[model samples]
Target: MSEENKTYTQEQVDKLVQSETDKIRTEYTKQIKELQEKLPPEKDEKEVDLANRLKALEEREKMMDVQDELSKKGFDRELADFIKSGSDIEKLTEILKNNQNYIPDKHKGTETTITKEQFKAMGYSERAKIYNENPELYKKLSQ
Candidate 1:
């Protein structure tokens, strides 16, 4: 049973979810490719950050491949964006694979995905704090 006037049936909802997930995955992949091209092999910090972000996005694709048990709850766009911000690919990947309300994958010892909202929910005020702490590094990174 769906909410009042919910036009989407279970099957329709599933397809729509799949489509959105697929789109995110494709966009993430495209971003990764772009970042890889942008990366300077000589180890520029910003380049590395961009590369790592790309890798994190690549790992995020697996979330789309999961059985979306929370279809009723709909996907969290903010959470999805937050999960992509992970510093290390493996750490972020681990978190995404273990989030609540969402269905678990067959593979155990998985990483849970984080959403932008979840990150916000977790209260990360560090970005500005870090920038304020080190204006020069922040300026360089921003450039």
Candidate 2:
């Protein structure tokens, strides 16, 4: 019983340590399982990613729509972000109507292309003159 006189086999000490470690591991495992069971099921990674992507696409589409509307009204495209965030279309439209960014497109109502019937009515020399003057216009009209 004296100090330095007692000796325990290495195998016995190892078994004792392993038993204590196993007990701790088992308790922690049980607790972890219980906590996990109480929690709601996790969403699939793919589903979460898809949902995020879809939201982004919708936002982008909304922004594009706002830009198109603003452009159609002669407002600067830079104002698209402000209009896109506004929930009320009427309010946004009114704002755009009053904005300094508004610059009426000079070519808006002026038809740049003519129908085949109109082309047929024009004389050959007139058509030849138009073709020679601006071939791109003739090509667009033909389209």
Candidate 3:
């Protein structure tokens, strides 16, 4: 057996993890401070987290990513058009109702797509359908 592949003791792993964490903490503190300062005063941490959440989702795509699935599910043009075309939150929520499963792993566990149970949780009832069985195009966005 290779010496490197041999199981390391738990104590050894803990030391390595602690060292890497300390390194990361020193490197990230500056950026965290800057982000905290730049955020608007009226915005709460949860709101900022939401914005960051969407930004992160928009930043990275899985192999069969959110956009790809959404396009395949025929939800992209409408969703993009909704967000870009200045649709209201209610309108956007309605659009999200389509393919509740159209949501990607990256956005799973988020309230991005609203369902009947979700609507009930929020005291909402119905939403407009916006699913296309098959979209003519499946384009990936640039990071």
- Count clashing residue pairs per candidate: 13, 0, 0
Summing lDDT over every window of 10 consecutive residues in candidate 1, give the lowest-scoring window: 64-73
Q: How high is the CA lDDT of each candidate model?
A: 0.60, 0.80, 0.55
TM-scores, one per candidate: 0.25, 0.38, 0.22
lDDT of 1 by residue, 1-143 (tens): 56875687799999999999999999999999999999876878998999999998877664443323222234444444333332334464456667745855664653654344443454337546546775664455444
Residue ranges of candidate 2 with Cα displaced over 4 Å = 1-10, 34-49, 64-79, 86-89, 92-143
Candidate 1 regions with alpha-carbon error over 4 angstroms: 1-4, 41-143
- What's the TM for model 3? 0.22
Better of 1 and 3 by lDDT: 1
Local accuracy of candidate 3 as per-residue lDDT tens digits, 15-121 = 99999999999889988999989987787899999999988776553322444544655565435433432234345556668755585787566455444455344
lDDT of 3: 0.55
Give the higher-TM-score candidate: 1 or 2.
2
lDDT of 1: 0.60
